[model samples]
Target: MRQNPARRNALLDAAIEVLADEGSRGLTLRAVDQRAGVPTGTTSNYFSNRADLLEQLMRRVRERLTPDPAALAETLRATPSRDLVKTLMHQLVDRTRRERSSHLALLELRLEATRRPELDPTLTRFFTSDLDANVAFHLEAGLPGDRGSVLLLYLGMLGLIVDDLTVPEVLRPHGVDALVDSLVDRVFPPADHHGEEVVGQG
Candidate 1:
């Protein structure tokens, strides 16, 4: 396999676009090569097969969707309250919107996983780890919610992202931001008189 990190990532990024535009069925090695504007067989040089390509693509999607560390640190500096959760959720929605192709490619990969049993385990592990990390972060951040709250928020945001990408018209009635605010308000526990305590401050 090729060992050029930049080239490999470029191929995976191209694959993401192909998956988004053509769905799993159309994601042939040749298609990735063409989308990437590289020589024929370039993708094959990097990825051994369709499954290998898919596994890499899944990882790339996570990398592309990960929160900006600087922004996250800035947000973490504030008191963790319903408002903070709202801010986090809004940032998530914005990131999804900005990386529309990555999100759509993720949806395609999910559907493909259902048909390919071999792919399911890898996909499941990736999603499970992400959920676990989110739950851990919520707890450590002193966010205004328990595990159930985090789970509900995750489900709600997943639905919202799917709608926003696939059928945005559905959310047009309420708008995405307003719906995010509602999700935070309804899913998280209300702040007490003193407000939610900061993560480390007395």
Candidate 2:
């Protein structure tokens, strides 16, 4: 039988809803099937087991959280790094909103990864890749060696996102800009930031 693309995505989407609305403990192939309106076996068909489902969901969430590399690089090449950070921060917030379900899925993944050492490698790899890449992006913004600091702030923002503590409007309007500036100041320092090569290949 040919797999249905729409149905497959529906199952995953339903799975996302299950994670977001019901938490990880509530995520099951049956639950996803119920939410997606597909047969119970449909979700299982796409995923082999519970771990497979969560892993796939985590992948989807990371994909959702990630920025467009080609575009970001091009923009970075043309724009000042200082300005880029705020834009990137704002964009992340928007992406989070767009993939709210995935966001919750990621949280569940994190919790699971924390509890299970085996999953830690995958989970850490996913989030660290984002942090490492963004830290590289920050360096492109002319902030040198600020990866650790940026990771912290980035994580802080993520926490706000997870807890629904932030209002995107305020974040972009003033909060994001201020955050960018403050992070740059503390992490880069004026003296350290003049003409340094952005970390990584940026």
Candidate 3:
């Protein structure tokens, strides 16, 4: 029903706002329609049911949350592997800070998926795509990280984002930058070619 991409994105944006404000239990077709300020039945016309709405919402989040190619290319060109890890962390913190609502909605989806076995495939695919893309990025940038390293870094960043958004005071005084630097140091530590300690040295 979204003959226009703008309208579709607007509705998805509305859904994210609803998820952030009202939680997953409050997300309904009617709620999305109302949140979008559209006529009744609008969301149902676009999305057949809650599952459909959630699937589209997941897709939209992926599209919106991915790193910008041009910006990433420049950063990769100018930064070393260790500094690049810090840059990635900065990007995560900045995006989470700026897009708190959307990120919150994503967290809701993760929890909701845990209770819905049918959604496991979609969730798995979504995360696998992220991991695969991350691996590709690391390879292209000559970053020090294997798939396992990506997994660990991703989990750490996800936890940091969740904490930053929910209980921000928990990370007070030290701040996100300091935490990120620590993570970068630990995740992509310095290594010599002959030294067998680093993850990506194969």
lDDT of each: 0.90, 0.69, 0.83
Q: Which tens-of-lDDT digit does each residue in 12-42 have in candidate 1?
A: 9999999999999999999999999999999
All models, RMSD in angstroms: 4.6, 5.5, 3.1
What are the per-residue Cα lDDT tens digits for candidate 2 across 1-202?
A: 6777767767777888898888778988899989988766888888889878776776666665677888767766755544465566566667777777777677777776777888888777877777787777677667434567677667666655764532455455555546645654454344336755443221
**Which ten-residue region of model 1 has the weakest summed lDDT?**
193-202
What is the per-residue lDDT of model 3 for residues 15-130, given as tens digits with 9 covering 90 to 100? 99999999999999899999999999888777778888888998888877877889877877765567877887898799778888888898888888898889888888987887
- Whole-model lDDT, model 1: 0.90
Report model 3's TM-score to 2 decimal places: 0.89
What are the models' TM-scores? 0.92, 0.72, 0.89
CA error at residue 170 for candidate 1, angstroms: 0.8
Lowest lDDT sum, 10 consecutive residues, model 2, at: 183-192
Task: Give the winner by lDDT.
Answer: 1
Reference-based lDDT, residue 99, model 3: 84
The candidates, ranked best first by lDDT, are 1, 3, 2
Of the candidates shown, which would achieve the greatest TM-score relative to the real structure? 1
